[model samples]
Target: MDIKDGKIKIAYLSQVPAPYRERMHELIHQDHQFSYDVIYCAKLEPNRKWELEYGNYKMHFLTDVAKTFRHNNTNVWALLKKLNPNVLIITAFKPTMLYGVIWCLLNGRKIIVYNDGTFNSEKSISMIQKQIRKFVYWVASSFMAPSKGTNDLYNSYGVGNDKIFRSCLCVDNSVFDNLPVRDREFTIMFSGQIIERKLPLFFANIAIELSKKIPGFKALIIGDGEQREEMIERLKQNNVDFEFTGFLDQKILPKYYSRAKLFLFTTKHDEWGIVANEACASGTPVITSVDAGAANDLIIHNINGYILPINVNIWVEHILKLLGNDNLYNEFSINALAMVAAYNHQQAAGGLVDAVNYALAEKNKSTQSNTITA
Candidate 1:
């Protein structure tokens, strides 16, 4: 429990490439009191090649495990035991999480489970998976949720108030920085996977409406996914002035963010869209959906950005407001940059450190109390 001097060993197990993992590693490394390790459970078929590469972490392939359930569950535990981590953190309650909880419970290791969004939504995940996730939520020692909505959802599912921690998603300010004070253009940008949930058609519709009204109005669509072809065809059919950049690396992503006058996020079921944070970090005012977790926490209505319901008319009105008033654009831009500071890497890691310290302190107190009673 005396983590002040004790060298804490923590491990992160997740399939996706966590952007904040390197920053977390660096923070822990610089601090002489803690040691951290990451075991990335990566898929084998088509590799997820990160542009801004994260080094200083161990990688484990999940190919063999993918073949069978027995292999996945048993082998992962063997790997965890070999690592001998003091605290195990699972990013999601997937099959990997089931293995993590079982192993941690058997070996008496602390477990932390993270869920960024509402896991039980009919549009997001299957009913069967949601039921299993509920069980996982009940067993975790601590839960790290990326948004207020997600934290509240877990609490609604019977997770203790103390066990649930609010750790919102953050952006690396080094990669995405404040935009320069220049003549803001009549350009709107939408970045992220072109999927059905993102409501790309809505962005296309906004582009069609705004292009006719404002001169030189354009929409920039970045990233590619299953819905890319459909979105492109829709844009062409509507005869909209939009640029489709097919998948960008983290290094090259800044160019897209810097060029845009405003960022439009229209995700229908996103738990906490980190792209919104990236856009805000770039000093571009954002128009995000009320459903987005980032919007719930970071956006302060007319202060930094606008949080509107899923309606293109409202989006068009907000876009026109930004284009018409340069003074208002500048004001929102300044506030957007200031608002994203609390969601930076340092703040996120600081929260993690505090959570670990709190959990360990409570654990030690309970142990001492039990010893006295015995």
Candidate 2:
């Protein structure tokens, strides 16, 4: 992928590709006018996984600077110099991307900031740290926010509404949207890590409660983590009717989604849970914690799914509520599919395209203003 002299050379500085990013890359490649590069971090820390392929796109993987926390890279400057892109998109506020950000700022290139963080989750930063974030916001020509929660945070930092772009934290809806849905039952499915933050114990508790209320209820958990052995042992000891299918790839996840009558996301706190979106797209209703970022935009309490606390009784009650009433289940399923339609790769890629064009257009106006002043 040689950069043409006159083309719109746009480069994305990212940690790595997950399903959402892979979809974005595929869509961005559809446009022939823009020369794009999806740069990557050479490796992730230890056992963490990104679960995406580099594929056929033009990519540059960088050398690591730190061994832990943020995984900053040292190769950003050299890569940016080589690419000399007209627009640079930073996926998060990392020191690694800061090199390219500062270089672009000094060289008069456009910078677009895409972040999924909101005050709702990471709320303990100091005022000084927030001011620094605002400074970054000041220079960024446009922002790509995944949900209303983040967009609100950017606005609080003095970002104008016009400059904010709504990019959904999406899944490949095409894969799950058309899968044949099963007859309504008490079958529940859970996806995501078995880590503590994800509340793997909460999942087991919910399954136990559901079993007590409904005879022959089944719960399928499809993931693995540090607590996998501990959690599985607990589920088995209690004799809960559950199956741990381990970690299934995105391509294989839909089959389980179709088998499920409902989906459970028991995260204590999450910036954005794309699994919730995946569940909705598969026409399976979702019950998520109100603190989950996806809950605000995706779950319509008792309409599509319930947004409740991490209480076992409450979750069990709602699970039974959705299961007992087939009429309500069908309605929620319809709304679930309809709501997830806008948060697909097609719409998300459109938002990115619009953000880039807006940044360039604004820069052009600024240039014209300076010329007129001269």
Using TM-score as the measure, the top candidate is: 2
TM-score for each predicted model, relative to the true structure: 0.85, 0.91
RMSD of each: 5.6, 5.2
Q: Give candidate 1's TM-score.
A: 0.85
Leading candidate by lDDT: 2
Clash count, one per candidate? 0, 0
- Which lDDT tens digits does candidate 2 get at residues 1-374? 23486568899888755667676676776577678898766545455565656555687778533256564676788889888888899887677777778989878888999888875875777777677687888899988888888888888888887888777778767777434445534388878888999998888888877777887788888898998998888878888888788988766787678678888988988888988888888789999887898877877787889999889998888888878887998899999999988787766776777777788883533211110000
List residue ranges in candidate 2 displaced over 4 A: 1-5, 43-47, 64-67, 126-128, 177-186, 362-374
Against the reference, the lDDT scores of all candidates come to 0.70, 0.78
Candidate 1 wrong stretches, greater than 4 Å? 1-6, 43-49, 58-73, 119-131, 177-186, 362-374
Distance from true position, residue 37, model 2, in Å?
A: 1.1
**Candidate 2 overall lDDT versus native:** 0.78
